[model samples]
Target: MYQNYNNNQLCLSIPLEINISSNHVAVAISHFVDSIPDKLIYEKAMTSGRPAYNPAMLLKVILFAYTRQNFSGRKIEAMAQENIPTKWLIGDPDTVPSYRTINRFRSSDQMKRLVEAMFLSFRQLLKAQGLIDDSALFIDGTKLLADANKYTFVWRKASERFEGQLDKKIAGLYQELVQNKVDLAMSDEAPKTDSKTLEKTSEQLTNEIERLDQVIATEPIIPGGSPNKRLRRKFKHDRHLIDSDYLPRKRKYESNNAIFGDRNSFLRLIRMQLLCA
Candidate 1:
């Protein structure tokens, strides 16, 4: 038997407002992103003869989403649907392009260039706003793994052992043929074969031998006793390194690097810090 106790309810409530005025971050980012010039980035539509959407507005929406860490096009579309500021930035239209269109724009080479330029522009704007400190910057590095699997790596030792065995077998066969030139006579008077088939077979064997030889020669050598084991360890330890150079240098083979979003967020953060300062 069990007894239940009716013990209490605590309710917390806070007033909520639905509408709010445009804020500086949104307005500043929108204005700064709009300052990026778009010239012939999109071709004129053939059928209806007008662009499907405003390139600038799309660009602004994408950059804003990127800066806010909302990289998914689907999410951005949802935001445009529900968020008033996003809708206003995107022109508050009755329709927005599907996520596919947004993804295509993000992946395009033109879009990549535009994003880079926008980053530079944001940096300049930050400088203009006296928000950037040439000195005193943070530097860090990270590693990103390539989308490849261990199965793709060829085992060097196994390949070398196979090649060595093949070479020894071929050498032994050649030695036996030289030692017993008893090919001077056919066994039990078998019918003689045409020279063409014999020649073709010889050529094929020679080609196969040569191809195997080339593969063995050109393949990367693993230094350890077991090439496959070494390769496994190396693959396990391998990383795609990324490094940031606060004091920018022109030419240095650093790690793979990307600016988070457009550098607009960085600029805005700096501006906020300056305002607080």
Candidate 2:
């Protein structure tokens, strides 16, 4: 069949649903943040300065970046330039933001409270969608892992129950793979590559499982803490590290609560216990 290409196309003519599947998260968050009145966050808008990206779109892209574990502002900037999901989130492929712009907006004092507000909004959305229960306590971190299904958490007396199953599955796959390789070597037919493919698949799965096992006890990173030593210190308390670092950080956070001028609003917005890790 002959091939055809539209080199001068002006529009994709793609359905919004199919287009958004690259990152449905962007759609969900943008909708929520767009509904937020700007006056609530900024006292007055600056009209004299050069125009910037829409706050709602920027906020959506930033929030989606965090979910993917991309924390560096430079990385975020690059994502805006290169990642289709990010471009789709922004709704304009040409609107690439500079790293400096992203970093400044991210580190702004206004963003601190704005982000909390967004998180509060997100929690409500989750509750409305029946992903999170009414109770505030979050004992299961996997809920944050994006598995919106799977409701129950079973108590486990032994670690091997889960790892044993993984071990058996991996072993069975490996055995099949080895048997296939042996058979291929013995056969006079054309060389078979399925054994090697199966080996690679099993290896990839085993490596991924091992990686998850290694990450189970890792610390939960508090966002926007790299530039603020005080905030990073404060987040230690969230991780249950009540050492010398925690007390001063706690005091500092309390002192800054009023300094930020959003103590009441912040408290009202966030009710969940701070369990970073």
Candidate 3:
């Protein structure tokens, strides 16, 4: 059995705007968001799914959150539930969106243009009302705290520097891995030592070491001592190379690859491109 509950059942309510001051930035944000051309927002609306939250409401809530220095989607979700001005902008408690939905809306191509347009008009409005001094210096240092896998950004030059260093290290390791005369054919292929190539090379070294172990198992021990010191030393050396050097470099390259995936930027022009591509 469940208790009778209804989201829409109204008992007693007052106008949400009454709780917010008219001069509040949220009030201004609401007006600016409403003034955004409907066609611009409507064109991006999804045609199939549950009804979408109004784009104006999302913009107003986001802009309001910005004024409060809250850039995270999860924080905005909580704000919608707890903040009076935010609640007023959303207009209905039932329509409060999840962090995922809020982030998707915030990061969309359409949202990018809309935010720029809104701020441009907003700045003009402020200037006309003598609310802003154009001569004053402004620095936008707002840090984004969103889904890191999807939205975290880093500079391209920094990524390139790191990549170049990794490539040099890989080249050096490859030369060491194939330095022996038996494996000299691999030296020609060393220049192609990308992550996958290194991984394949590691597997080859493992197989060669295993084969050597089998040969040592069959080889006669010298009278009373170690089985063929020559093969034993060779096995130990190859094992150390893979365990201490090659494997670690391979894993580092793979981990850095994942962290730096698709998020690099050019710091000066600030274009978005893949870090690894």
Candidate 4:
């Protein structure tokens, strides 16, 4: 069918305010802030340092920013400038707080107990609404966005025994499958690089990609009627990833790392852990 993914860009425009207001995080945080006793925030209010931001509004921004897995002051400032949801939480489109200001506010003793109290307030609100009872509230890690060192995340492989040799292990597994004479290819169409993939190595990632290439030289990747549709779709995508190419620069790697962008092949890195197991 018409090769694959023929992308065409068309410009579309809409009011930015609507996008901000519709975000559930913004709405919930706004409601939560509004529900808080104003006296709690006003009690700690200071008259120093320029006209201050409304404590409730500032608290809402910090908490909402934390929910999006963003903990860095600089990142929050950047988001305030660009993220619509963040702007909505701030209650002003033009006011992006400085990183230093966000840092000071979040780290200050005045605010240290505020987040905890906010959670308690939320629990109370839930109880009042009969959504929960007086019993202990459970932590949903996703909502909490528990803190971690941005530089120190543990990749899934780090939990496995062969963490360091993860890539090589993947190569070995795919190599074994090749030796066992298994047919991993289905598409007769040429392997297409449809997504921006981070480079695992300068060379294209795995035997599956090379094998798929060899097959595509003779056939198109045909969709299979595997009983497990998800697995089938996953395999097809992994096969395409195999035939992809590595990026050329460190700049590309940084951009890719930020979003954990697609990679030329992760199937080997992923499947290798399975085989090694």
For all candidates in order, the CA lDDT equals: 0.53, 0.57, 0.70, 0.58
Clashing pairs in 1: none
Candidate 3 residue spans exceeding 4 A from truth = 1-18, 130-277
User: How would you encode candidate 3's per-residue C-alpha lDDT over 163-220 as one tens digit per residue?
Assistant: 6776777676566555543252354533664656655665666666677678778877
Model 3 is weakest, by summed lDDT over 10 consecutive residues, at 268-277
Candidate 3 backbone collisions, by pair? 156-265
lDDT for each residue of candidate 1 in 48-144, tens digit (9 for 90 to 100): 6555676677887787777778999899988778776677677654567678888887787767787688888888888888999588765455334
Q: State how far residue 243 of model 1 sits from its true place (Å).
A: 28
Tens-place lDDT per residue, model 2, 1-277, is 8788787978766544326563477777667776566764554557887876666677777888988899898999999988878888878777888878888888877788787777777777777779999667656653334333334322232322543443454345345534433221325243222334334443443444444445543646658643233433333322232223333343434444444462232222223344445
Residue 239 in candidate 4 has what lDDT? 45
User: Candidate 4's residue-wise lDDT over 158-177, tens digit each?
Assistant: 32333224334435535544
Model 1 weakest lDDT span, ten residues long:
239-248
Query: TM-score for model 1?
Result: 0.39
In model 2, the runs with Cα more than 4 Å from the true position are 1-18, 35-37, 41-43, 135-277
lDDT of 3 at 1: 100
Answer with 2 or 4, whichever has the higher lDDT: 4
True-structure lDDT of candidate 2: 0.57
